[model samples]
Target: MKLTKIALLLSAATLLPNLASAGTLEQVVKKGALNCGVSTGIPGFSATDSKGAWEGLDVDFCRSVAAAVFADADAVKFIPLTAKERFTALQSGEIDVLARSSTWTSSRDTSLGLNFTGVNYYDGQGFLVNKKLGVSSAKELNGATFCIQAGTTTELNLTDYFKANGMEYKAVTYDTSGQTIDGFKKGRCDAVTSDASQLYGLKLKMDDPNSVMVLPEIISKEPLGPVVRQGDDDWFNIVRWTLYASLEAEELGVTQANVDMQLKSENPSIKRLLGTTGTAGKDLGLKADWAYNIIKKVGNYSESFDKHVGKDSPLGIDRGLNKLWTQGGLMYSMPIR
Candidate 1:
């Protein structure tokens, strides 16, 4: 009887991989479009223009994945979601992946039944205050009122920071950033706090960005990235490595202008990446030239960063921690082979 029970467990384990892969990719193909979850409106991250067309870093991420699958970046339907609604949308299969800016945390990973692919942005919590407030540092803001969002890590982190610093603060909570910023503008709070990247984006909408300055201190690490439901490993791999493809393309000297040229190169890694030399794509249940589609359509990590988040954009953040590892940053991809 013990042997029978052990045999049943072993057989179930062996069938798991086959069961998971049996129709996931096929289902996506038959659907004709990838449904992507993204932030409602955050400039440079994800936002809808006047025409209601979605665009930004997160939008590009979804497009990149669509490019890999259908060879057409436009083959995607964007489902805009707020922070609280993102996970539910993904779990309900309303979206294939949540490309919204979400911090990767142990609790979110384990308890939430979500899989974070990898970090796209290395951000941190920070404070943005009017320069006239005469505050040079966050530590100086004792007993200050702050404009913050409710039901977010920003709120919890705000509480913990004040508690740890022995500071007193009044939190003027709001559900949306528009309301939070309006409250700050109306003098309801001395300071406004959120992710540092968000501070930059938010400040761009202010009457004068020079009037509001971000504090030098960045508290708490925020490794933000895309996420998906936990059960589908193949779907997870496709999304995760679609992000990695951008980074890898930049590292390998492939760009939108030169991906076609590089695809003909004789280098082993580059060839495997371009689908000329290996089964890398087939292993992921995608076309051999999956990376090529992303590179040709969406460009690479550097291109995406420069176009949306780098110095040329209003946010104008230096890619200090986001640069490729060889350039002394943390953007690294696992081996494609």
Candidate 2:
């Protein structure tokens, strides 16, 4: 009898961690908000506005998850993190989801105890230099000193690119993107290197934006997206599908303004996506209207992109690789069915 009792206790103890990890959704629901990790401030990605509310593409992704769970896009507490701090915060459970402009790399996926949901943005590492440098191409910047964000793939890509090109350069690393830009502005380095999207965002922060220009060379592929802890498949699915729901909504011609009208869509894919039919929400431990809420509250991926980083916004970035698959770009969603 004592042996059986000891075995039972051991089994229960073994299950405890899984049980705790599985309750992330429940914990967020009880807490009344989802804890979302974002960058300190990346314009058109994640940043506080004049009203002190977080707004940007990555910010909208967090709102989509909140809308899925609570039907409230505003039920999110955004925690701003520097480059080196983002992953540690997620690993420590300081944030439920991380939506900073983080690249999805094999090392990060296998070693960080985290899982990237999917690529929300396709990016590449590039250089930003003062127009006065008279260098229109990255090749001209050989032996230049660069201000780079520490603890990012940007740093590694910079090293590899320079080495492979038989060029030598120096890197002055900063703890955050803001500091890197500041370092560049202060003339601490000849150029700043980061994901091209970020270089654009950083350029906008300059006293005179036109004084700097992003080099035409894209040296590395950066598939940036949201991330969640690895042990909880339930929460993982919730985050992953929330992203897919937005992409699917866009593919099906659903928008925040038109999601309500889409309820009557007879098309099977549209119906499944809008929660007019199917068990997608139930499979993910959510209400049938969960996706409907996300669409109605957060808008589709296109809407968020356009509003935050595309032509409608200050960034005015073109939807090159970020365009929907049907439109000849890489953004594609799995079938909701």
Give Cα-based local distance difference scores for all models: 0.88, 0.92
lDDT of 2 by residue, 280-337 (tens): 9899999999989998998999999999999999999999999998999999998898
> Model 2, stretches more than 4 Å misplaced?
1-20
TM per model? Answer: 0.92, 0.94
Residue 284 lDDT in candidate 2: 95
Q: Which ten residues in a row have the lowest lDDT in candidate 1?
A: 16-25
Q: What digit string (tens of lDDT, one per residue) describes model 1 on residues 1-337? A: 9999999999998666446444555677899998899886778889887898888888899999999999999999999887778888877677888998898989999876678999998989999999999989999999999998765689888888989999989989887777788899899999999989888888987888789999998888889999987767888899999998899989999999999888779989899888998898999989898999999999998888888888777778999999999999999999788
